[model samples]
Target: MRMIVMIIFLVLLGLLAILNRHFLTYPHTLNLGFAEYKDMPVGLMLLAASLIPMLVFYFWASVTKLRAQADTAKLLRDMESLRTSLDSQEGSRFQQLQAHLDRQFAEMQTQALPSSGSASEVASLAAKMDAMKRDLDLQLDQMDDYLKRKLG
Candidate 1:
């Protein structure tokens, strides 16, 4: 695509140069500076026209390169933000898992101990522990859903 555009631009430049030469040779009713100089050769006009377009193209090329650099910088910034968010979420998930495991271990210890009081108290504690574990699992699942949504 770039090559095709370049070819088209070169053809246009060639045409402009030809037109400049023809105009320079012809008598100018409304002569702009160089047009009044009949003694001056037609080649100079053609050269000036051709060089002007090339200079303009050079400036435009530089502008496009700078814009591309800016775009690259913005992409890098966005990537960095994503990476930071991922790292933070991972840390939070690890802490949550650790806390859940610790709570489960504590519950197991309570279950391991000998029953000293009435059966009702022990059964109540066990039931509450089970409910707490279930709630924690639900919370973890919700966290997973939130993370998936954030990533997508």
Candidate 2:
């Protein structure tokens, strides 16, 4: 839409220039040695035309730079908050893990203890194993003697 407006303005300017071509072609004769004060020179008009665009562009760039700096500062604050939160969460997790390890260590200590009268129980278990071994030896001897007699 802005391009359309600029195109229309340029077309009107061109038409006006064409219509005033005869007037622009006629040169004016000026009298010499006339004191002309407060007159604008052609160079000043050209300088104004050139410098206005540059000034506008400079102002635009500065405004955009300021906006970008503000955005960067806001993001940095957000990042700092996020970093602090993460550090706190990690610290809590480490503490939780340490507590869990301690609990597991305490549980392992409970499991390591055997029943009461452990030495007496071990002696009784050894006597039972010896009795079973003697019964197995007697059975093997009876089987050997029975087999030898049957073969004879």
Write model 2 residue lDDT over 82-151, tens digit each, in one string: 7567657966885687588567655654554475565455556556655865786688568657644643
* Top candidate by lDDT: 1
Candidate 1 residue 7 C-alpha distance from true site, Å: 15
Cα lDDT for residue 28, candidate 2: 46
- What C-alpha lDDT do the candidate models reach, one value each? 0.70, 0.61
Q: Model 1: residues >4 Å from true position, as ranges?
A: 1-35, 109-152
Clashing pairs in 1: none
Candidate 2, residue 12: Cα displacement in angstroms equals 32
Q: For residues 1-152, what per-residue lDDT tens digits would candidate 1 score against the true structure?
A: 55477778878977876777665565434457765554555565556677787768877987898899999879777866886687689769977876886787677657756665635566676678679868977886787677556644
Error of 1 at 117 (Å): 25
Position 70, candidate 2: lDDT: 90
Error of 2 at 73 (Å): 1.6
